[model samples]
Target: MTRYIAYIMCPALLCLYLTGCDFEDEYNVSPRRNFESLWKIIDENYCFFEYKNVNWDNIYSRYSPEIEEQMSDYDLFRIMSDMLDELQDGHVNLLSSNVGISSYDGWLNGYPSNFNTEVLRNTYWSRSQNYNDIVKHNRIVDNQIGYIYYGSFKESILEKDLDNIFSTFSYCKGIIIDVRDNGGGSITNSDRLASRFLNEKTLCGYIRHKTGKGHDDFSDPYPIYLTPSHGYLWLKPVIVITNRKCYSATNNFVSKMKVLPSVTILGGRTGGGSGFPFTSELPNGWSIRFSTSPILDVDKQHTEFGIEPDIEVDLTDEDIKENKDTLIEEAVRILLN
Candidate 1:
């Protein structure tokens, strides 16, 4: 048995000898592979690269050395981040460190979790949340209340100009706003989106970072506000539909809405990814997204843990299949009552 094992080892070592590369060379291959993996994902997934001045060749030369030297996985992620900044598309990006708990463990163990797991999970949650690409305009329900569903925080949705939408909802029994699939987009969009909901302008929430917390006015910038706006639905009871998938700018939307006198969050705990991720593309074609802006609540509590719902409602698999929405039913019932 020992002789047979030695014979097998001898051939394997002989092959390595012929290759003229040792363990160090083999180990280095991993970093390059990682770099390639990221680079390729972007090349395939990004909507457009020409607009971002994507010079694939130059990107590789610029970051290969830095990426190669990254001994720690976290540092390697940083290198990937630095590389992805070259391409400026917000939607085309990477995931977070904490959210990647499963992936990190799987990678280290060599068994590795599937790459699309998070995306798939989030996408499934989003679908379950019943998110639509475009927010339905505000309309009266039974001539008593108004309703609108803004599935995402992307400003593009509001680019159509929301002045009309807000104007329409000015008078109603109450307003029901749904943001279950909002994964978050521009904070500027948050400002404008939130602005449409305000009747009296005042401090909303504070913006914080790894440094600490802050409370800048709406005009201050992303998450830079303490003064609250009466919210367009000030006179109208504002009912926000939330779920575990509510995250980032969406969570910020919820956190701010919580402060409004008229707003009541109904549903589940929000999806916990907060903070604005600064993004860039790598030479290998992978785009990286990292949190650059930290968001805090009125109490200066960061939204990373996600905002809890006031009315805590959930959806069962049956709810999903039967196309039945208990949350919406509850909202309509509350408005009617």
Candidate 2:
């Protein structure tokens, strides 16, 4: 009888030790709470909504049941991503990817370094094999020419690297800023980077657009840039190389520079990707960004379609083999003449 009582008491004590409030609380990371937190954020910060309201009731109705059903976290996030994608704006985009989110811990840190490239190539290479923009860099040929390829405006590191790279072109008789694969970046950076070509301090122009402050009556704010340097400005003929891939802040840069008497844009119509992207996160830990501002040309024309080049040229397979960029080669020919 004594041994039996001891065994029973011991088991009871073990159960009491194991079932504490802290452990139960840690195990109860309520998915519903996470969803509500994100929903409130969207309601308050989103530039616009379906009925001028965030429509949270509908969102909760659509997603809450699934979350309660105990679906995996990834599945829940993808559902939120699809709903946000309906916004159809760049700033409204889902985070770059799952791995990117896990690696950076959040969106405030720089986008991963895998977006664009930096090394100037002595020759041309076919990029049809891969579509990533971050790994592709500015390539140069003939050791005398220069190429600056951009993927987008999201990476701050790339922007810092650009100022240093452009300064090196002070001696080049001509420059080919290959924005062929550039999607866009911070509009301010575009102006800051492009200012290197101007001979003196000048307004990069007010990058502006309307906010639906009230229906058709919109409110606009100007995003402007001014050159910071007095000297070391490359006054040489600047031949901006572009293609369908050149877009957004890049397109904005192209549109503004086209007005300068010293700059010449070369290529086909740029990629139609101009629009200022603003960002927010979705439920289930997915991120989204949408374009709240518009990208306008120097003439204030919107490039929602894209910017057209002054001299259009296409690259052929042979040109890549010879390490000769048809676009840059053409720009040099034109500038030399």
Candidate 3:
């Protein structure tokens, strides 16, 4: 294995071997083969190189020297994990047997959380103890406003669930859908929920995928639309409360919801993972996942990084001591007026 890798590294044989052989089939489980395979998989398949302005070649140059044939599996995984972190994308991850999985944390690390579920629960539970398990809707305040805290898009949301939840809030003038701390789940769930807010077919975003190995090689952007739900529709004013934890499908939901005339997004910027992620494997049997298809807003801009809120409000220390949610307070004020 060492001899084969050393030969491949030789200037003259490098081009010959890479051009003539299919590296995917050359699963030698050697450090060099696994390293090369992991790097190449991301180079050709992963999206967001151009969008994130990452220099893949430069990254390789910096990290390739650290990969030695004598290195243990743990060391190799650490090096590979560090390489994937350069993308700064939450969807990008490296799963290994020795160290479990590596996750990108910069997306939520530096940003203010802007949400406290305990505070929200305590503040609202005092007023209204009733809540539906299917939709997670709680009627807070004087039963004038409907409050639903949706923590995950992964959870099944049926049309019947929406129907039941809205029925409970029939007398309310407005609704607050809290997506704070939602790390996203299924896009189908996102579409299903967003459909309830639309009156007609709406072009909410665009999606594009790689067509070739080039960094800029992508198919023409295709429009993604949301049609009105056949179920109960909410025509009244709606407020979506978001925070840094709102990601992936949740981000997609917020993007579509913000386009509606009756909806207002309030809170911190969403932790965006707009790319539809696809999985690949390294030669050593480790798994890697990354964003392959980039999603854009109606304006054709990449929301892969994040989508800013209409009104940016943070969770203040004072509010925590008082057991108050500032973002929720702001949303209530907006709905009341």
TM-score of every model? 0.55, 0.59, 0.90
Q: Write the per-residue lDDT of candidate 3 for residues 1-337, one digit (tens) a residue.
A: 9998887779677778788776647557799889999999999988999878899999999999999999998898889889989999999899987779999988888899887768876786455433343236777778888988877887877789778888888889899988888899998987888888879899998999899988889999999999998988888999999999999999999998988999999999999999999998987778999999999999989888789889888889898889999988888889999
Task: Report the candidate with higher lDDT, 1 versus 3.
Answer: 3
lDDT scores of the candidates, listed in order: 0.58, 0.57, 0.87
The runs of at least 3 residues in candidate 1 whose Cα sits more than 4 Å from the true structure, single-residue gaps closed, are 1-133, 138-141, 155-161, 210-223, 226-234, 280-285, 316-323
Arrange candidates, best lDDT first: 3, 1, 2
Q: Mind sharing the TM-score for model 1?
A: 0.55
Error of 2 at 86 (Å): 4.5
lDDT of predicted model 3:
0.87
- 10 residues in a row with least lDDT, candidate 1: 101-110
Per-model tally of clashing residue pairs: 28, 20, 0
Pick out the ten consecutive residues of candidate 3 with the lowest summed lDDT: 126-135
